[model samples]
Target: MTAHFVQVANAERLAADVMADVMTPPPPVDYLRWAEDNIIFTERESPLPGPYNRDLFFYFDEILRALSPDDPCRIVSVHKSAQLGGTVLANIFCGGSLAMDPGDFLYVHPTENNAQRWSKMKLVPMLKGTPALTKLFPMKARDGSDSVLYKERIDGKGAIQISGANSPASLSQVTMKRQVQDDLSKWEMNNAGDPETQADSRSQAHEFAKILKVSTPLVDPGCRITKSFEDGSQEKLYLPCPQCGHMQTLEWENFLANLDEDKPENSHFVCVDTECGGVIEEHHRPAMFKAAKLLELNGVEVWRSENPKAKRFHRSFHLWSAYSLLQSFERIARAWLNARGDPASEQTFFNDVVGRAYKTLGEAPPWEGLRDRAAKSDHPKGRIPVGFPIVTVGVDCQADRVEFQVVAWGRDYRRAVVDYGVFPGHISTKECWAFLDGLVRQEYANGYGRKIGMDLLAIDGNAWTEDVWGWAKRHLSSKVIMVRGVPSESAPLLARVKKERSRSGKLLSYSKRFYNFATSVLKMGLYRNLVKDDPLSRGHIALPRGLDDEYFRQLTAESRRAKRLKTGFIAYEWVKDPAQANEGLDTHLQAEAAAIKFGVRSMPDSMWDRYEADRERPPAEAQYEIEDLMAPGLPYVPPAPAAAPALPTKKLTKAKVRRGKWMNADG
Candidate 1:
């Protein structure tokens, strides 16, 4: 067995040696000679004016050249960059192959417009150009279709046609030697989900047996064309490293490794793979290159030309050569950088193009200014911080315990979770009552001193709703009320009312007034409006300084794609990451909404009637300030003066209230 294994190894080595000896690079074949002997050609100039006169080969002619005498490569998937003469190259390959072996050939592009464009721009021009080719077959733009051509061969005639990727019916009727998918990624809108993308690709694979996919990369890396190249069968066009014989993909990363940073703009590829470290110039490329129309070499599954050992003129090449012809190195470099590599052409190199976006995301949002201003503003002694105007207490109730916080926003719109409550989760109804009484008592004690009112309290209305509301209705007076309904919508209203800015631009009041004022400020568009001192009402205290700071950072770092709506552009907000926005908005919206519905003012009978009348009027006629009607309580009236002079007032002492032992014991 050992001897047999050694003999097999030796035999394999011998065969490899013989193959390498025979694999010497062939001399460059002249285009003119190859055309006469191998390919039938027709040529024409481009309809659009350009530098070179048109002398092109037809699709069938090239197809004929690429296929074998008896059996041909069934499919060719061409992954391509834009332009670069890929379409023309595909045409040449198909035409040359089909011309030799007369068979059906179907061409597919993303859309009908593109199909027609390819027909006019590439297929027709090539057919009309070459003198010998034009005589062999003739084609003209048909009335309803793009173009049609005939291939009269020794055996039989073949037909070539164009079809759109979206038109499945047209594609199903045809079976051909070659299937060409041009820019499949362009079939769908960016950010769309289409099952047809995969369906069409698989269908085409079955029909043509041989697939050629070609496309430019989409904005998203997960595009259909990209997936096909990565996951589908690959006929990788590999070039040999100058220092090593190993074949590896030649990608933008490989290209950038050769760049000379000192001469930043003038850098090119130099093979520096750990083993090679060889600088490969363009002139030496032809000899170092090898072509193998790979079939199922890796996990990729594709139908190869029936004969696996057959080495034919079936070639696939990634021609970055077209870059120099159509666009500048800078333009291509930027696009290349955007794909995987960093852009090298811009003034700041990486930073100017990519770094700026990074910087923006890294920086804080402008709203941070409002947070700082709100935080820094002075408040009356013992009050919740001046920044905390509208305070919404969120309570999580359990059988034994109730947990809550008085989140206060200052007059400037800054907010904070000022206090919290957590009792036994298994507490009884009496205990729950005690918990409620203690919370209100503590709030009144701290809040009245600061002169900052506790605007609203939102309990978990999802559970224990009846218990919480009933407890509040029985024990709590009009001094404060538990906010009911959806906190997400109500908290903001309360926060808006409590928000206030002083004449000098500093937040002054920590009342329901502040919440109202803040909403008005936001309504006027706080993000865009730059205050003289605050500059962009971001400094408005609607949220806590800490939250506001982070929120601002997120807002500035992110970009919004404002979509056009019937009325105006709806700026769908974006955070750099999904997690941040999800965590923040729930708290912000709920807290803000809670503030809106809390501490609502009562109106007088006459004023109420008038407001009702105005509300009944057409919205156009309802011009009165809605603010006044929404304020708490009936209108004020003055008391009549006494007839005689009043006695001088005297201050009452604590002795009066604690006149007896009972009052002293209670105190």
Candidate 2:
């Protein structure tokens, strides 16, 4: 009986020891130290798998420290490029927070699919690889505390919830102490409003709550991350020159001077300091990064704010691929070289490599400036300019009236607006149609004293499709055609002609074909051309002296805007105020489309010379027939047969046959 009592006493002592150990609080440690000692990188997630190394990403040290619970900063914003370890730093902070300072953590992505992808490819691997995180989330089938999107600590101190910015429900219904917003710039607004604000509201209940926002910027005016970064203490990494000790940010312009196109690997950075223009090689990047300091625009260290008593809650940092060890100078140089002359590719380089927003070229020029420039132009209205070989017309049909713009095309896509006017009658009436037909049939004199007929006339069929189509069918002998505008930005200037089909899916022989043109693409092109100051430059638009201020306002009525769609993707569209009229802009776009369809964009110099020679021909001599000037690549249209004598019965050589056809090419 005494032995059994001793056994029970020993068992009770052992149980007390286990209970005491479980109840004891963990030792105090900052987020940086905790992350370095506890975090592990799996092979699938990291290039340098195994243990987390602070030295490899020394630039992230200050950022990581700012995320600590002890730090006064409640918000950390990282405006960074891809492959710069920004996302990895975010992951480290989250892991450290869950293991060291237990709290209800929330992770938000741009979309549900993005959340699922990051959870499966990133979160699970990270948690399973780290011993500290695995202890909290065993990830077993029977473990009620673990899941693909949620994980709970064994001690029941806190849990993590993963969600997407697109789902309003996921961003609400729970209060979180820590939140991470990945790709915040790409987040879209839900039915409830801005996803960023919705997700941030969840953390309002906790006084010491923490939020980390990270993303590469998009366009400047609409980027959410850029706004956040500007609101906080804007800090940029400034590396000291090895020779002069002058601190400077690594700018792309300075690097371009030393970039060897033949051998990009030999590229180096030149110090921007005027007195100390030292050449810094790529090998010196490591030491420079280690000794780098974060400085504001005024050259003051960010950490050493002037007012220490002021409670600054947000800390923002900017990083680019040039500062990252994973990216080489050679790769950046190659990408820049390849992206030249292409706006889309260059935007990607700016966002993903330079970590800056791309200033889009789609912006409209000031209407006042355009009006002033037009007033000073030498060209006159209602007459074609010298050296112009083609004339095209664009018509905008409205319920009350119809607007038309006549444009002359010269070599290299140069344009001169010859005339523009409006007919007051309704488009559905025959009077308006008669006025447009008269304009199309009228011949205008050029500087060389030769009259030229309109090469192509494109009329918008969107408002009165049936009326426009009926008019177009009647003017089939002329160059009149029907066109409609499409919303796609990537569409070509002129899409393929779509033919009408019968109910049996058979092609209708007598059906009229209409073309779809990309309105955004043409409008962007026109706006860019309107700002060109040099008349000799290709794509330069020359305005006649008679254009009024109202014309200029109508021309610049619309402006390009960045809009987020329901799918969380950004789309650029031309938007105008409801009170504004955009008939001038619409007509110009249609005229440009008509010119493109006439093959003016792809005309060769030899063909243009032939047209010029024909214009300079004497009036007595038979001028080259207008019908024979069919645009290259267009279906051959047989011209009217000219009155000619019968050919000789004898066999003709190639030269004689050609001469004979010159008299009647259509025969």
Candidate 3:
């Protein structure tokens, strides 16, 4: 009886001791370091599964540390290119929040679809694959405790609700201690003007609420994320040159190695230091990463600084592809080389690849800028200039007449308006289209002697859609296409291509292909081309001398005006001046559309060289016989018949021409 009483007392005491120990908080540890030790890369979904490699991601150590609970700063903005270990930062942040400071976390994406995709591709895989995380956030779809859009920690007062920027109500309803907004730049506009006000409203309850904003950045400074990036401390990554040991931010201009043109892949990069221009080979990246450091720029450098004030509490960083271990200098150089001349592509290179906003395309050209640069051509209106290879035709339909132009394209996208005129017939009549066909079939002899014919034709099918559609069916070929304008301001110069259907609802036999080209983007390209200081730039137009002043007036008729969006963002559009006609501008834009569809931009130099070599030689004179000229009444002379060579008696060394058939020949 005495032993049993003692055992029960000891068991109770031991249980009490265990409960006390469970209440004790875990010791402080670096959140990033802890993640590196525990987080598994997940082999089923990721090739790199295991403990995180701190050396590979050493640069992020300071940024992640500042996001830790120990840090005083409550907000952080990571403006960067995609797939540069930004997700790893997100993972470690969530893991730390769950383990130490247990509370709600809201992961926001650009849209509902984006949120769902990230949960499936990133969140779920991350939890199920990592043993450490799997224990904390186990999957249980049936119980409603764990789901794709929401999750509750199995052992803590922690939960995560994933939502999109579009759902502002959801963002405000659920208060979270930490908000992870991935791709913040892509968030859709809200009725309230800014989605940030609604989303940030949720975090008002917590004093130390963490707001993490990450994005690749969009064009407009009015974009929510771009504005945020400017407001925060602008931090940049700098690396010591492996060769010269001079610290510098690696920019696209510093290292230019691929001017050789033919073998672009062999492009190289070097240090920017003029005194020590040293080759920075691929192998030197590891050392560069080791020496990499982040420098926070002053307020003056931030985009659109008002009073040189940067948010003291928020940490913002901007890193380019140059510092990315996965990206190479050669790869970035090649992308720049291809994107240099064209605004859309060049902007893409700046925004997506380098994670920097592109410079504004600039203002419209002065009306006389291109007019002064016009090439003096001796060839007449119907003739193609020397060195011009391919020709494209642009046709515009109107109520009274059809305006058409023949534009010749050469290497470097050099354009020549060889011929243009008004067809004196209404679009509703058959004569207008017939005149178009006649112009298409007409060939012009170029200065190089090459018989130049239109390689591609694009006709605007804006008004009189039915008439244009019917006419396109009869005239459409591999080289001919109909273009309909899509007023989508954000779309590229070429938006979507599809096949046109006849009245019977079946695809047409000829010219079935139709393109929904964005007029706004094309106009932007046109304006940018005209504004080029160098005549050699792509999209530059060389007007022939014969064109009258009225043609010039029509060509420069359109001027760009900024159109304000509902969200207060500025969008520029080409508005026609009421005083001048824009038919000439439309023709040139359509001609460019035709050239783009024909793949002239992608044509190889060797193919262009072959085109350059061919000359338009005149057709040879017809061969004629003397009998054709001689009259049939003329009498033949006997001496002429006797002049025929005598038959050889001996075996001839060489065969002699004989009129007799093989069977009748001498045996």
- Which candidate comes out best when scored by TM-score? 3
RMSD to the true structure for each prediction, in A, is: 23.6, 13.3, 16.4
Which lDDT value does model 1 have at 348? Answer: 25
Number of clashing residue pairs, candidate 3: 4
Off by over 4 Å in 1: 1-73, 131-133, 140-156, 172-177, 189-208, 219-221, 241-249, 272-276, 282-667
When 1 and 3 are scored with lDDT, the better candidate is 3
Give the per-residue lDDT of model 3 (tens digit) for 1-667: 4554433458777889999889887667477767876676757534555678766666576678768767666778887766677787887787667766778998888778788998898887777766667788867646887877888998758888999888766676688899888887666665555566667778889998888888876555434556776778766656677877776666556555433366655556667789998877667878776555322222222122232245457777776676666776667777877887887676677777878765554345666655655545444555676657788988888766677778888877676778766655577687776776676676666664345678888888767777876777676466677887765443456644555667788865433467777675566566676666555777566666656555566777776566777655554455777645777778878888888888777889988888776543322442435775475887632111111111111111112112111121244
Ten-residue region with minimum lDDT total, candidate 3: 648-657
What does candidate 2 score on TM?
A: 0.60
Best by lDDT: 2
Model 2: number of backbone collisions: 0
**Candidate 1 lDDT:** 0.41
lDDT computed for candidate 3 = 0.68
Please give the CA lDDT of all the candidate structures: 0.41, 0.75, 0.68
List model 2 lDDT by residue over 1-667, tens digit each. Answer: 4554333458888899999989997766477777778777767767888777876777787787778766788888888887788778878878888887788999999888789898888888778877888888877746667776788887889888989998999988999999899988778667877788888889999898889999988766667788778777777767789888787778777887888989988888988888988888877887776555333334545333222333268888888888887788889889887654334455568888988876665668999998888888766666677667788999988766677888988886788987776665667788877887787787766664566778999999777677887777777624877788986543456875556665798864433557889786577567777888988876778887766565787788888887876645454667986666777888888887888788887788998898888764333443546656556766543322232122111221234322432122233
Per-residue lDDT for 1-667 in model 1, tens only?
A: 3554333468788999999877975444233233444433333333334332122222112333333233354433344555445555565455654554345666777666677877776766555664434644554334432233223322335556677655655555455655566766555321222323432444453433555666554322234454554443334334456566445444555556655445434434555476676665544444443121222234332222222333232333222431123333344354434332111112123222221111112122465565565475443212344223345654445444554445554322334444322354332378667766655555322222222344555444335545655565554333333332221100123333333354687753332222222221122222322232441232333332222243343223333333434432122222244433221222333344454444312223464454334322222322445665666796622122112111111121223312311111123
